[model samples]
Target: MTQPDDIAPYDLAIIGGGVNGAGIARDAAGRGAKVLLLEARDLASGTSSASTKLVHGGLRYLEYYEFGLVREALGEREVLWRIAPHIVRPMRFVLPHDERQRPRWMLRAGLWLYDHIGGRRTLPGADGIRLDRHVAGEALEADYTHGFEYSDGWVDDARLVVLNAVDAHERGAVIRTHCRMTAARRENGLWHIEAGGEAFSARALVNAGGPGANDIDRLAGLVPARGLRRVRGSHIVVPRLFEHEYAYLLQQPDTRIVFAIPYEGDFTLIGTTDADHSGSLEDVHIDARETEYLLAAVNRSFRRDVTRNDIAWTYSGVRALVDDGSGRPEAATRGYELPLSDEADGAPVLSVYGGKITSYRHLAEEAVDALSKRLPALRGGPWTSKTALPGGDFAATEQPAFIAELNARYPFLSPADATRIARAYGTRAEWWLEGAKNWDDLGIDFGAGLTEAEIAYLQEAEWARSAEDVLWRRSKLGLHMSGAERDGVAAFMREGG
Candidate 1:
C-alpha cells in the first residue's frame, strides 16, 4: 500500500470533501498548518450539492426562536457574497403568503427580524409586496393576493466546495479526491488515518463527512453525543418555468416551503422534499413520490402546470442534520454543531453536525476554533472573512465591467463562452483558455458550452474524476446534453481522453 513517507505528519486529516471539510481544510491551511483533505467521492456530492442553493439567514428558523443560528448565518451572508461575488450573487425570493397558512402580521414580524438580525448592508431587507402590483407576482395563482420579497444569495454549491479545495491547495494543503478515509484510530497521542488503501499519521482529525460524520467518529473509536438525521432532499429540473430571475418560496399544505428558482441558462430548478432517509448513501435517489410532490408544489402556485414528463433531470442527496430528536424533518435544526470528544491519551476528533452551504465558511472557522486548545503552537486568530475564494478576486458589488473586460481580451470568442468563463472562473479563466485564439482552438466540444479544455482543466486542477463530477456538480452542462453525449464523455474519460 502507498504511504506518505519521510514527510512531516499532516497537522490535520480532514475526512469528507463536503463544504464543512473543505472549509476547515482551507481554514487550517491558511493558518499555517499542514493539511490533507480526503474525500470518499467528489466534493459536495452529498447534501452540499442537493441544497436549495440559497445563502441566507433561515427565515423560518426565526419562528422557531433559533435566533443565534439565524443571526450568525445572516451575518456571514455578505462575507460569503463578498468572497465569491461571481458565484454567490444576491437573489431576491418572492414569498407569497397564504391566508390559510401563517398570518400576514406574523410573517411580517419574522421578515423584520430576518432583515435586522444579520447587520444586512448590501442586500435589500425584506418588504411586503402586493401580488398584483409586483412583476414577480405575474406567474402566481390569481387567488394569492399578498406576497413579500426578501434578499438572499444563490450559490453553485458544488463549485463552492471545489473552490474551497482550490483555495486550500493554493495555500499548500494536499487534496486527495476519490480517496476514502476508510478507518481512523488513535496511536501514540496522534491520529492514525487510512485513505485510498493507505495509512498515515496525523496530529489531529476533523470528521466533516456531512452525512457520514457519525460513521467517521465511530471508526475513530469515539462515541458521538449526537447523531445526524439522514434527510434526503431531491430536486427536479424542467425547462424554464418562470420569467424572472427572482426565486419563489411557496408554502405547501404540509407546512413546508418549496423553492422554485431559475436554474442554469434555460431551466427551472424546483425542489427539495425533507423526507427522512435511511438507505445506502450511494443509493440515495429521487423517487416518484418526491417528483409528484415537487411538481404539485410548483403547479399549486404557478399559472403553468408541470407534469412528470417536463422533468429535464433529477438529483437527490442526504442532508446530515443534527437530529434535535425532532421526529419532524422540517422542524430539524439547520444549524451546525461541533462536538469534541474527550478521550484519555489520544487525539480528539472534531465531528461536524448540520450545516448549510451558505454558512460553510463560518462553519470552517468555528471548527478550527474547536481545535485550538490542543495545538497551542498553531497560530489561531481569525482569517477567512474578508479573504476571497480561489477565483473571486473582483469588485464585490458588480461584474458587468469584468465581463466586458474579458470580452475585450478575447474578441473572437463567443459571447456565451466568454460570459460563462468570466462568471464562473473570474480573473482565472484567462489561465485555462490561454492560447485559444478561436473556437476550434478549444478542442472538442462536449455540447452546451463545455469543451475538452474545460474538462482537462477540471481533472487537472479542480479534482474532477468522473463525468457526473463535471456535468452535474462542477457545472450544469448535464441539463443541456443528451444521454449519448454524456455517455461519450464518460467513455472518453475512461479511455484517458
Candidate 2:
C-alpha cells in the first residue's frame, strides 16, 4: 500500500464523512486548524442522505416535552436556509386535521409554540387553511376539508454533506473519501491513526461516525457510558402523488406521521418508519413490510390508490441514537450528546452520540468549541454561522431570480435543465457551463440533462467516483434515465473518465 505523502500531524482528525463530520471539518478548518477527514465510503452514503429531507423542528417531539431540542432545531431551519439557499428552500407543510388523532386545539397550540419558540423572522408562521379553498386540497380526498399549513425547509440532503466537504477542502482541510480508519491509539499525547494503508497523526480525534460511532470508539479502545440504539428509517419514492407544490403531513393510526413530498419533478417521496435494527448496516433496504406500510400511509391520505408497482425506488438509513432506554424507537431523542475524553497522559477524543441534520451546524460549533479549549492551536471563534457554504452566496429570497438569470444566460439550455442546474449548483453553475456555448460543448449526453461537462465537474470538484455517486447522490438524474443510459454512465466511470 502506497503511503499518503502528507503525514504531518493535524490538529484534528475526523473519522466520518457524514454531515456531522463534514460540518466539523469545515468548522475546524475555517478556525485555522490543520484538519484531516477520512470516510470509508462516499460522503453521506449513510444516514445523512436518507433523511425525510426536511429542516424543521420535530413537531412530534413537542409531545415528548423536548422543548429545548425543538427550539434549537427550529432556529436552525432559517439559518440553514440562509446559508445554503441553493439546496435549502422554504417549504410549506399541510397537516390535515385528523379527529381520530390529536385534537384540533392541541395541534393549533403546538403550531403556535413552534412558530414563536424559534425567533422565526423570514419563514412564514403557521395558520389554519381550509383544504377546500386551498390549492393543496385539490388532490386530497373530499373528507379532508380542513388542515394547517406550517413553514419548514427542504434540503438536497446528500449535496449538503458534499458542500461541507468542499468548503472544508477549500479551507485547507485534507478530505479523503474511501479511506477507513483501521486502528487508532493514543501515543505520547497524540492520536496515531492508521487508515487507507497509510499512517497519520493528530492532536485530537472526533468520532462523528453516525451509525458506526460505537465501532469507531471501540477501534480507539474507549468504552462509552452509553451505547447507540441503531434504529432503521426507510422511505419509498413513487410516481407523483400530488400536483401541488405543498407537501402533506399525514397522521397515522399508530400515532406516527408520514410525509408525502413532491420529488424529482415527476415523483412523490414518502417515507420514514422507525424500527429497531440489529442487522448489518451495509445491507439496509426497505423491506416488504416497510413498503406496504408506506404505501398504506399514502393510500390513506391521497385520492390515488398507490400499490407496490408504483414504487419507483426505495432507500433505508439507520440512525445511531443515544440509547435513552426508550420503549419505542420513534420516541428516541434526535438530540445529540458530545462526550469528550481527555486524560492526563493521553490525547483527547470527542465522540458524537446522536444528532439530526437540522442541528448539525450547532453540533459542530459546540464540538469545536470544546476541542478548542484543549488545543490552543485552534484559532478564531465560531465563524460558520455567518459564513456561506460553497455555491450558496445569494440570499434565500433570490433563488427564483437566480434561476431566471441562469436560463437567460444559457439560452440553448431547456428551462427544466436550466432550473435543475441552477438549484443543484447555484451561482457555481457558471463554472460548469464556463466554456460551453451550446449543448454540443457539453460533450456526450447521458440523458436527463446529465452532460459530460457536468459529470467531469462532479468528478473533479465534488469527489464523485462512481455512477451511483453522481446519479443518486450528486443529482437524482437516475430517476429520469433509462437502464441503458445508466449503464452507459457506469461504463464511462469504469473507464476512468
Candidate 3:
C-alpha cells in the first residue's frame, strides 16, 4: 500500500470518488489545482451508482415545498443531458392519480408547478393522460384510470461517475481507484493525508465520503456534523414488463413513490424503498421488508402483478443525508449541506453531507467554489456547469454519425461491440481500437461484448483497478454475461493484478 507522501503534495485532496467527490476533483483539477482523489473501492460503489438513475427535478418534492431544489435540479437536467446524450436521455414518467392518495386537483397543481419551474427547453411538458385509453394503462389496475406524464431524464449513473473521474484524470488529477484514505489530520497549516498505507499533504481537505463521512470527520479530528442520517435505499430488477419507453411513477399507500423505469435493454429497474440504516456502509443489504414494500407498490398500481419470483436482481445503497431531524426519512431533504471545520485555524476539512446523482456536477462546482475561498490562488471559477464531461464533449447530433463511422472502421467487429464501444468511449473508441484489423485483433473475448482491447484501455486509460470495476461499474456487461464469463474476466484481471 502506498500513501500520499509517496508522491508530491497536492493543492487539494478529495476523500471519496463517488459522484460528488469525482465531480469536485474534476472541477478542482480543471482549475489547475494539484489534486488527488482517493477511493476506498471502485467509484460510485455507494449511493451515487445505486440511484434511480434520473437526472431531473424531483417531482414529489414540490409537495414538500422544495422549490429551490427542484429549480436547481431542473436547470441542471438539460445541461447534463446535452453533455452526455448517449448516456442520459429524456424519460416520460407517468404518475398515476389515486383517490386514496391526493386529490386530482392537488396532483395537477403540483404537475403544473413542476412543468413551469425551471423554464425547461429540451424536454416536453406535463400532460394529462387517460390511462384506460393508452398503452401505458396496460400495466395499471382498472381503478387507476388517469395519470399525468411528465418528462425527466434517465442516466447510466455509474458511467456518469467514471466519466467525471476520467475527465479529472485527463486534466492532471491523480486518481487511485482501489486506494483507501486511512487518516487525515491538520498539522503545520496543512492537512496530512494517508491512503493505502502511504502519506501525503494538502493545503485543503474535502470529505466527500458518501456514507463514510462519519469516519472521515473523526479521522480529520473534526466533530461530527449536527445531523448525518444514513438512509438505505434499494432497487429491484425484473424482466421487462412493458413495451413503451415511458417510466411509471406509482403512489404507495404510505405516500411514498416507486419508479419502474425501462432499464438496460431487456429489463425494468424498479426500486427504492427507503429504510433507516444504522449499519456499516460496507454491509448494507436489501431487507426482505423493503422487497415486499416495493413489490406491493408495483402490484397496487399495475394490473400485471409481479411477485418476488420475478425479481432478476437487487441492489442496496446508503444515502448520507444531512438529517434536519426529519422523523420521516421520505420527507428528508435531498439538498446538500457543507459543514466546515469550526476550531481549525488554517487548514480546513470541508465535509459534504448530502447530494444526489442528478445534482452531483453542480454540487461539485459548489464544493470547489467554496474551496476557492480558502485557497484564493486557485486559478479557475466554476467551469463544469457548461463544459462537457469526458465522453460528453462530442455534440449530441454527431453521436449517430460517430457510431456509424466506428462500424465502418471496425468491419470485423460485431454490431453490439461497435455500439458498446461507441457508447462507452465515444470518439475515443477509435483510439481504443487502435490498428486492430479484425476479430482476432481484439485479442481474447471476455464475453458480453467485452474485449481484451477494451479491458486494456480501461486498465491503462480509465482508473479501473479490479474485475468489479470492469464488470459492474465501468460497464454493466455483468448483467448480461454468464457466470463463467464474469469468472473469466475476474481471472484475467487477477492475473494482470
How would you encode candidate 1's per-residue C-alpha lDDT over 47-91 as one tens digit per residue?
Answer: 778787888887878767889989999998899889997788888
Model 1 bad stretches (over 4 Å):
1-5
Please give the CA lDDT of all the candidate structures: 0.85, 0.92, 0.84
Candidate 1: what lDDT? Answer: 0.85
**CA shift of 172, model 1, Å:** 1.2
Clashing pairs in 1: none
lDDT of 2 by residue, 37-97 (tens): 9999999999998999989899999999999999999999989998999999999999999
Poorly placed runs, candidate 2 (over 4 Å):
1-6
Number of the top lDDT candidate: 2
Total clashing residue pairs per candidate?
0, 0, 7
Which window of ten consecutive residues has the lowest lDDT sum in model 3? 1-10
- Which candidate has the highest TM-score of all? 2
